[model samples]
Target: MMRNQTSSTSQTIRFTLIAFGLGVGLTTLVIGGADDATPIGTKWWPSEFGPADERGAANRITPKKVLEARDLIQDGKIYQLGRLYEHGMPIPGKRHFSLTIPGLPTGLPTGNNQMVSNDELVSGEIGQVGTQFDGLGHVGCRVNGEDIFYNGFKLSEFGNPYGLEKLGVENVGVFLTRGILLDVAAIRKADRLPNGYVIKPAELQACLDTADLEIRTGDMVLLRTGHGKLWMEDNDTYGEGEPGLGLAAARFLTDRKVALIGADTWAIEAVPHESDELSYPVHQWNLTRHGVYHLENLDLEELAADKVYEFAFMFSPLRLRGATGSPGNPIAVR
Candidate 1:
């Protein structure tokens, strides 16, 4: 039988789970900055790791945490939690992803051995396409005519076309921690949520209550809105605004100390944003302010189908030095 998602079940979580603190240091930075897009006069510089640290929330994955996560793998079953990178996979404005080969047998036999090989040319936003991981440098805001990134580092100082000098995807180490899949779709008893749906804190809390789950500190929390069902079926419709966490939901999750947030949608939060003026406030709230990470365009259907709420989430972004993001297949083991 499925876990009963009723008010009475809330006590199940409260009784079984212990509150975990964000063990990582959180040293706030005082910088001069103000914008309608960001918190007024707020900054996350002089990070807990130090003023120059770049790993962000990844610091929460300690050796002890890894061992704990390892113990969760009892059945040795793994669920591939990433979308397939292809020609039409719901890309947003101006972003692109394509793979081509000049010819099936693009290579010719040059040596006497007569070895034939096939090669393909790949290009177009690999870091942010398909199943993508957003880095600290992926999003930032213009502050007083200066572009600032995570930890309040100036863009002029670290931004480079070739690669970032600081806050690059290379800085975020591997993530092998606890993962919780919040099946909001099942909670709503719907195949998929309507576009532009804003998930409120009460809904989130109630979903946790329904799932009999708790959001532990430093955990990688993924929200399955059932949007992945449209992944390859209707690319255009999927590209449109999606149902996801609202700005309020972002604040609530940040307070819970989740190290990362993933979703089947392109953007982790609601598109068109809460206020017309804000584009990606949640990105700024987590990636910049609270040092949290984001994994987008995931494939959580298997986990949801099996009702696997908890697992050992594992992902190691490609060490693509200075890239803003990384594309890879994250896995969840139960």
Candidate 2:
């Protein structure tokens, strides 16, 4: 975990609040005493969407929500909020992203015509690569001798070698709602927050106050930490760790009933983690506990630079049947 120190970026810092730093909330929650039979009280099963619900938070995108989102558009200006999917981008563990064209023409010329074609094959963890949408089926906690996913769905039902049969990316509909960018780096008076900086609830409130914007239910919130500036420029350092929401911050957004949360970093939660025992606790807290989805590896630089704090954000994940996630570019318009 990187300590809170003066970042090397040229952008001047504004807010002088001490960096909340890392390893904050994990100590109080777990006593290191729970067994497999012990119930996970984190909010699972019998969702508000009903027992058989598969779409999770996407159900919040009702017609009423659509109209509300459309109302935010004024100048018709759109900002692309997804990052480029290229070979050099940093990835977690053994995952990767790459593109290639097999041959010169890539395909044969048309008969009796001058038309030739080029086609490229994309190879990578399609659902997990750049600018990805994490579905309910994507995360779960093991308990009672089974791996439980969203709505207590077991791995035996949806987990498959080919694709997930349930809670797949196809189950999620679309997101069209008010997008709020909490530019934490800008608010903290830093071009980029140091790695492992755990964003606290106090910082979030200050950010909202700074923007004069309040987070409403079903809002898609984006946290801009400026970590993305290293994207494609330095893959190794980018993959090391990141500055993001702590457990407290996760609870803050989840309690507000936000449909989805995105960020400029790879994971929405702080890297190196607040707890070494819990694997992606925020992912579980939102996806399993409350069904709030997460969008990671986003590009919010343009939007941040323009100071577009609030706008209409929309993105449709490709309906890849039985896939855990979908790769696509999300857009924000003001």
Candidate 3:
């Protein structure tokens, strides 16, 4: 029995020594490979939040932080911002600025001298077209794997009900912070990034390096692939084509602790990888899982040429109660 115990003790000591040696070797390799001047936190991929054990999940930028970032941009200390709107730019859809109200009064007086004027205030439906904000309630995962509106809020919620009175647009209020634009197209030296191409982590890092910028806490990062231009030219191809960030890049951004993410494309992430696709995983990962906001269909051509890495961001969503999203007109000022 004494000899057996001694043998077990020897095995334990040997195992401990092996583990210690392996750990030391790994540490040396990592330290040696990293750039000496790289910030401690920058050397390795940073956690979305400060630490795992802290309250809340990863990549959560508080509202207060956003406000502080915004103030800096407004002071003209930062420059290079994107223009959200391009005049006469056609939005790819069946209805860009069309109005369709159900049950219009039939047999209205039709005469050459007929006049339709609003002499008194009456309320029904208003602005149903043009640029708009997409409120949080605009989209959601299926409760049982089926897409359904929350509380039966009609599609009209995309417009009307302006402000936070109904949908808490007030919660979003005015966002002031640093804005970073990643010109992915320039990195690849392509006039436009092809559709269906999922951007990888290495590619994203390369693009950032080319731009000579690093993401700071509470930054609004906008990724431009020249997809918006293609989208404007051909909606069908743009909607179904191969452009956008991949899951890995999304994870990296969330891990980097960005406050909001925007892209010049439709869906932020590459279409789901599965043949039996369910939900947009990026949306799930960022919005539902990580509490990160997404901005889509932004016009970023001008911003890319400006070579701006930072700016003041501002946006307000239409206040619609019981809605999934608000068609917001978001803008960035340098």
| Best model per lDDT | 2
Off by over 4 Å in 1: 1-41, 110-113
RMSD of 2: 7.6
Model 1, span 158-218: residue lDDT tens: 9899999998888888899988888888888999998778787787887789879888778
| Candidate 1 lDDT for residue 96 | 81
Candidate closer to the true structure by lDDT (higher is better), 1 or 2: 2
Q: Among all windows of ten consecutive residues in candidate 2, which has the lowest summed lDDT?
A: 10-19
What is the model-wide C-alpha lDDT for candidate 2? Answer: 0.78
* Residue-level lDDT for 330 in candidate 1: 96
Error at 50, model 2, angstroms:
0.7
TM-score of 2: 0.88
Q: Give per-residue CA lDDT, model 3, range 292-326, as digits (tens).
A: 56667777877677776566676555544544344
The lDDT of each candidate is 0.76, 0.78, 0.51
What is the full ranking by lDDT, best candidate first? 2, 1, 3
Better of 2 and 3 by lDDT: 2
The candidate 1 region of ten consecutive residues with least summed lDDT is 1-10
